[model samples]
Target: MLVAFSLAPSGAPTDSVHDAVAAAVRVVRESGLPNHTDSMFTTIEGDWDEVFAVVKAAADAVGAFGSRVSLVLKADIRPGYSGELTAKLDRLEAAMEQSDDPA
Candidate 1:
């Protein structure tokens, strides 16, 4: 399973969300799962239970800093598939390089 999620504190007392984002990202980084974090989202790949647990913890971390919390999640549940995170992109790049067709 691959999950890309964004968590942040809504109704925050201040404009800067770095603290809240850092807190949530801390949870993901410590989860021992293969993961990556970009500006908008953090993507994690792991078993269902482990991934959901990390998400829950991350949300909890964000909730601590604000009156309301927001979580946005997108998941690709490709059963029997693993390492699609990097593999998919690798395949696309390979195809692009090999193609002789003019763009």
Candidate 2:
């Protein structure tokens, strides 16, 4: 599961990205997911459904920080179970390739 997150302060980026990442980690941990990063976003792989819930929880926590949280969740949505939503650039690539095909 992936949660793309970005933080903006009132006047400037007062809080280092590290701090944001740490808080995000705590949030994810509270929701009970393993393995989080301190970069552009956080990604945790687990029972897809639970991961989705945790993503929301993490977002909520970030919002509580007073920083504008910008995130576009990417995950698969199956009939009842939501799966991991990575990048869909592959689909676009395929479409472009077909368009360029001689046939």
Candidate 3:
């Protein structure tokens, strides 16, 4: 399973949430799970229980920054498939490359 999530804190002292976001991301990085972080979301690949645990821990870490935390999550649950993180992007790139070639 691949879970992509974003976490934010509300009622924070400052308008910038970077510090809170960094806290959440640190939890993800230390989990030893296959993960990727971009400008918007952090995606983790692992079994359901393990993955959600990390997500929960990350959200909890964000809670310290403000009165409340909000999380947005999306999941791709494919039982037999693994490594879709890079593989999906690889396939998309291959398709785009093929489209550019003249027959």
Give candidates' CA RMSD values in order.
1.9, 5.8, 0.7
What TM-score would you give candidate 2 relative to the actual structure?
0.49
TM-scores, each model vs. reference: 0.91, 0.49, 0.97
Model 1 C-alpha lDDT per residue in residues 1-103, reported as the tens digit of each score: 9999998798888978899999999999999888899999999998789999999999999998998988999999988988987888899998988896577
What stretches of model 2 exceed 4 Å from their correct place?
A: 1-17, 76-103
Whole-model lDDT per candidate: 0.91, 0.57, 0.97
lDDT of 2: 0.57
Residue 76 displacement in candidate 3 (angstroms)? 0.5
The alpha-carbon lDDT assigned to residue 29 of candidate 3 equals 96
Give the alpha carbon lDDT tens digit for every residue of 1-103 in model 3.
9999999999999989999999999999999999999999999999999999999999999999999999999999999888999999999999999999998
lDDT of 3: 0.97
Ranking of candidates on TM-score, top first = 3, 1, 2
Cα displacement (angstroms), candidate 1, residue 22, comes to 0.7
TM-score of candidate 1 versus the correct structure, residues matched by position: 0.91
Error of 1 at 84 (Å): 1.8
